[model samples]
Target: MIGKARGQEGREGAAGVLPAHGMTHYPAAFYHMTHLFYQSGPPLYAGNICTGRSGTAIISLMGETQGRVLLVTSGKELLMEMTPSMSGRGMELVCVPTLKYAADRLAAGDCPTLVVDFGWLPPSERGALLELHKQFPKTQLFTLESVASMAPAVPSPLRRLSWPLPMGFADQVRVIAKPVIILADQVLFSTGAVQNAFQQAGVQAESLEFGAELPDFIRRQSEARAASARTQKPKKGWSLLGGDEEPEQEAAAAIGNLVVAQFTGSAAQAGALDAAVRAVAPEAVCYLVSGVDTQRYAMQSLKEGQPVALPREQAGRIAGIMAESAEGGETRLKQRERERILLLDNFKPALTALSQALIGHGYEVTSSMDGAEALRLTTKGSFHLAVVGTAITMAELSGAELAQKMRERDPDMRIIFMVDQYPLKAALQGVSQVVELGLDDAILKPVEASRLIFSVEKALERRFLLLENARLLKETQEQKNQLELVNGFQKKFFATVAHDVKSPLTAILGYAEVLTGKLKAMPSEGRYAANIQTSAKTLNVLISDLVDLAAMESGKLRVEIGTLNLLAVMNDVYERVKIAATNRKLNMTLEVPPVLPPLAGDDARVGQVVQNLCTNAIQYTKEGGKITIKAELKPDRVEVSVIDTGIGISKEDLPRVWERFFQTKEAMGMRKAGFGLGLKIAREIVQRHGGEMGIESELGVGSRFFFHIPLNGPPPTEGAAGAAPAAAPKPAPPSGLPPAPRPPQQPQPPPQNPHLPPQPPQRK
Candidate 1:
């Protein structure tokens, strides 16, 4: 009765069958294995033991392999024979099928060569080679025959590791012994590596380059034999899953949006994949197949017809983005419209600050509960990036699935998938990106304002690069149309110039002939010559306006902006064009309100708008009709209008009245010929001043051409206007000369709106 081993009651079983180079067969009902199993006299273990090796370093970690080992298998048959045959070779024996329960004891300065019977478990529990390494450090592995039926399926994670020792002091060295396992493809990998992925999972994976076959279950899936390609599916219960009746549905397959599938159970690994997807394509939505149910659910989604798929090219997008580095360029390519980013998270505190941080970096931000409203938003497609956390519990599409669906509509839509656990191995089936969601990347739940800002800014820097490059390319193509407009206008300008110059030249010569002969005897003939001179002057003004417009189009209009009194500026304009109105026999009135404010702008440009309106009113006003000039001050702006009871503009001509070289048919015939550049120039000047210019008219009635100029600029400070009218008018420069500044040409008085109560029409 070889009962040498002791339990709590100090009892042992007879041990038997032992191998010289293999396990010393010792069995006890309560057997426990440790390097130095102090029992049956000192310690016992026999076999060639070595230290951790080079490259294959597990051996070096077991500092003393030449120590006794307590060995036990659960089966009592093996223990019976080993007890009598044990003698002094076997130390203490205890039944243990797995190494996890004994990790602490193994680390208790004892030999950690574990002969585990893992055959009882299915491959799914095992995950990968590294799982064991991660769970049980410094423990060498040996296998038992028939372990398949001996161990439980999934190890209970809640079970605490047992540490049974009398007194202890472990060595200073921390053993990170990494084992070497040659993959089926002959690819050798260090079991101790931090990133050996699927190979460590029970997916029967080889090296990345050597993977060809999927597990029997996946291979058996009823999918068409289409070549492997990127794919993604909506989450379970999402609208794509057949108008989901259930409010809460997670994405069946997170791998639906990846280029390859890797079976991994670590939530960290899943997030890592998600991040990888973003890094590669910044806007790619990564899906995870976290489990069998998820995979099946996703496959069913495919059979039912997907709502949408990746709408844009991913690799092409990334490449284009790389080509157009938005961060590197100081100038942004996008039109200055503010962009908004949405962070859909249910974990409020964890992600709110993060969303706000994104906004701080100049992006508009909108948040949702999760992916519930996410798909709806993406369908409308305005946001640039969607950041989803794994902990959110909103119904419909999960954050991950929403991202995937969004990717279909906007290939460049950036997505960040965060998770709560080590996703299931099955979830990685077709994923390309997997990011472990945690605080590792400075990602905080209830994220720190600064940290949240940094992560999103970094992501946006990348996403914006891609988006801006694409947008700029499109804009460049559109700009081509503008160039076409430029060329076409060049031809048109030349034709107008020829006609204008020729008409004036003929009138000048004919009038010169008449004045030299038939009109020489009568002073009245001088009036006829003056008419010819006026026509000549008009043509000259037209040519000059054309020249100025050409310069503006060429981007060379170099007028400097400065502070000038708007009232004074208007008065100067009225003085300059007052004669033009008089010559047309048009009655004109100026309505100036009391006390107006000063304005900051290019004195010349403001004057141009005033002059153009006044000139236009006078030109179109029928003989004996009246024209009025009015200015008014509002809290934020000053408005000026030139009203005429002349040949009013037709609605057909109103829209194009400001278009360059566009002349009203009346102006082309009845009114004196003039270049179409006046209103165009006025519009440009107003736009530059951040003001507005427009007109209202009715043919045969009259026209009101008005413009509004802000009363504040050039630092935008408050100041009183120099409303005093000019004491004595200085001689004005020739046409095209920017109006001279007149002592902060403040408004002479508050001008009225062109539509203001007319101060009773004036009589001619």
Candidate 2:
């Protein structure tokens, strides 16, 4: 057994083999030593040793290599062995699998040399080691080998390194290190093969034992490489990764070119952070990142960028630093819609007063006495408006020049010049130039705070109006799209209703008609059946009319015109209305010229117009009232009128009489339930036939309703002859029974039935 080394509990292992100039190679048994060990005596103090339990001793050994290290290994075994003991020390070790990886690291200024275990490299990776030698002949390559002769230059016995250390040891390496010497306890035969390959590839190999002299050489080499790298230009930016605990204050301070505050909160909070920063520190640049769901309102409120999540304390410190910079430096935050304003003047009192006034008026205000400083700040920041004192005259830059510079940075930035008595002319001239560049206004000095505030308010108001207009325009377009969607839905729903409802309606009508015929012998039951059949028929007609109105509104209603006898159409309507007139005990007459000319119209629709008007007269006119229906041929048109002594329309109700489903107060009061579509359909039919229809009425008196159509059939061409003319004034009605009493007035809209297709409500 060998004697124990100093401060160690275990004895040194026996030296197994050595060359004339190589260090002693210890036996493999010594690798598991329980205590620190070294050479038995001072024989060049160069040999393999094991420090038991104390990895720090190994750290001392690793310190002997260059500061920046590119560690090349066939496997992680060697790098893992060195990491734990080497961490928290000054050495920077970068591990790689091949020499090409080492070259890449070197090219990126990661390290200058490859501390490679050539013996551990498999055959496939050996080619890159040899190729790298050709490309970078000066790169130092190390090999762990037992035989000294394998590497001719400074060949030394090497001990294989396979010690396992604590975790996170590799993380402590702060920067890259190069020209490293990897310690190992046992060398392989492949080490000799690697050295032979390198020599064949025209690359010299050097080997040296780790001892006192190597540390100085490595330090000097690292310094030289660092100096050279400093002289060379950098290719890109660099960032350092800090540990997971509290962020290193020194590291954060070093990267102060940008400081981001990421607010993780509601979108409202995030969106307001910009204005908040402006209000709190007008020079602070703020960006917000919200935690709100992206699927709802889009995450566009925060305009700058995404927010960063960091420890609260660390974020707070960063915020403090940014606020401090905003206060102490010439930099300011970018301006926004809330009207951030920058005020500059050499006059301290005036500047202070103006700033306070602006602040009182709810403006974010930043002020500086130096014009050049203002210019410098403009480059780093933004302002909605800049108020410059023309009286200011700085040696470096004048107020006008500062204004010009700010405008150059932001063309839309508003500038307001303040002039004293003497410089008013010059200020005005400068104002004109900047006006072309976007100056807003100028105010004379000795101006009232109220006036200045008004000017500021006006400027901000105008800008806000523009922004509001743009926002409203977007909203308007959205509403338009919504309306179009509603219209499409209505069209589809009406079509479906028309198709689905008509079948059931036809069955009801058919059944009621059969019941009416079967119950005719029983007078009371027959009356009920007749009522049901009448109601069903009425419903069928209403449905048909609704479909027609929908088609007419959508521009799909077809109109077929032909010559038709005016008297015949009127006679058909009178025949339909005569029973109602007799039931109501009213006098009704149909006046038609014997030789009346044929009118140009759809005959059924023309008859429908006449029938609806006469029915309305019979329904409204009470007992003993008179209704007169007349058709007369004019020069170019035929005019028909239905005159009734009935409860007439009020002035307010007359205008909307033609609207679909619009019923007057008197009409609804008569206890008459109707769709209110008759008059509307009548007018639509007449108008489609290129004719005109209208009603003349007075409340508590009588009424006259009329329609006129072309007598020569459909117009042959544009501006064809015999176009329908306005109707002639009707003669007074013959003396008859009293007019129907009008109901008390109460304005109300037309009753609506959801089953019917939707129409715009008529104004009462």
Which candidate number maximizes lDDT? Answer: 2
- Taking all chains together, the TM-score of candidate 1 against the true structure is 0.29
Q: How accurate is candidate 2 locally (lDDT)?
A: 0.54
Tens-place lDDT per residue, model 2, 1-764, is 23444433123322211111212322323332222224566332122223222111121222344344455554435554554333323344455444544565566653544555645554345446546644765443443331221221221222111112112212211121222132211111112222232344443333322222333434444455456555544233332343234433333322111121212244334434333333433332222222122211111211212221222112112222222333532222221124678888777667766765675565656777777667766753367778888767667666777677788897656778876655657756755755664666778776667878887777767766766798899999999999999878866776677778889999988998898899989999999989988888777777777677667666666555676656666776777879979988999987766555434567777788888888888888889999999876665566789999999999999899988779987899883556787888787677666566877899989899987775434433223232332244232222222223424434433323232355575455
Q: Write the per-residue lDDT of candidate 1 for residues 331-436, one digit (tens) a residue.
A: 3333334555667777655555555455445555666664656667775448766666655544665445556567787776666555444454423421323343
The CA lDDT at 477 in model 2 is 100
TM-score of each prediction = 0.29, 0.43
Ten-residue segment with the worst summed lDDT in candidate 2?
182-191
Query: Lowest summed-lDDT stretch of 10 residues in model 1?
Result: 50-59
